[model samples]
Target: MDNIVIKQPRLYTPLQIGLGSFVGGPIAMVYLLWQNFKTLGNQNGTQYTLAGGILFNVGLLLLLPQLPSNFPSIVIPFVYSLTALSIAATWQMRRDAIQHSVHYRFQPNWRVLLLSISLLIVWLGCAYGLGIWLDALGIIDLDGSAITAGKDELSF
Candidate 1:
């Protein structure tokens, strides 16, 4: 009997993971990581990654409103993006080296792009829905009265 090794059909490159993180945030990065784990046939990694990712994102959402008004907006994105890239570089790269060849085919870039866009839409929708719910509950008003008016109101 000979040892048998099966190559992955498709795997995402680190670049794709980084871009997905940049556009879709930590959740998207986690999704990509989960996909990689699933593809590699590591059921435990897939499950843990998903659970951890959800918890992290939930914590993040809860903590976001507590940030000081003076806090820089870019910091959060920068931190998550860097973290995702680091994981891709270290973990995924090691897996690729062992399980895949130099000529291995990666998942298409468009798939990442689509996922990013879809995640963006979902995030925006959730935010909007929350805002509406809060408004209905008298917690916050979604009206534009709080916004400062521009000098000129021209037709689009």
Candidate 2:
């Protein structure tokens, strides 16, 4: 028997891939937090991921209503902020993973990829729906009035 090593497709650089994973991990954490919020009361071991997810989703949700409506005005800055956070978090995690001798394997598993993509779409869709529900119920205001006046007025 021969030892054969099969190479996998590389969609991005190690850094890029790590960053993608890092970005995704928090998003996953956010979904977990939302699940917790839906099911259980505020308890232990949910704070860190919950807070991070809430902050990240808040930043993202702030941009959604303005997306395609305002364009280059508001969405760009929000995107920039998201990118900066993703990159910074990715860098930190990558450094830690390297130090801990984490294995960086790039296997092109269609099942895993499809499942992940589907899960992401569902998660984002649910978040958007939740935002809309909250907005309608006045539980939270997407118009940013709670933050500042004229904040939600889409400006170019």
For 59-148, candidate 2 gives per-residue lDDT tens digits of: 666645646644565444345435534543443233344344333332244533453456557657866797888799877777776756
Model 2, total clashes: 0
lDDT of 1 by residue, 1-156 (tens): 598876646777777888888898767878888888777677987888889888887777656645676999888877887887777777665436634565346888899999988887776676667667766886654574433233235424
TM-score, every prediction: 0.72, 0.38
Candidate 1 positional error at 91, Å: 2.1
Model 1 stretches astray by more than 4 angstroms: 1-8, 94-104, 134-156
Worst 10 residues of 2 by lDDT: 8-17
> What are the lDDT figures for the candidates, one per model?
0.74, 0.47
Clashing pairs in 1: none
RMSD of candidate 2 to the truth, in angstroms, is 10.2
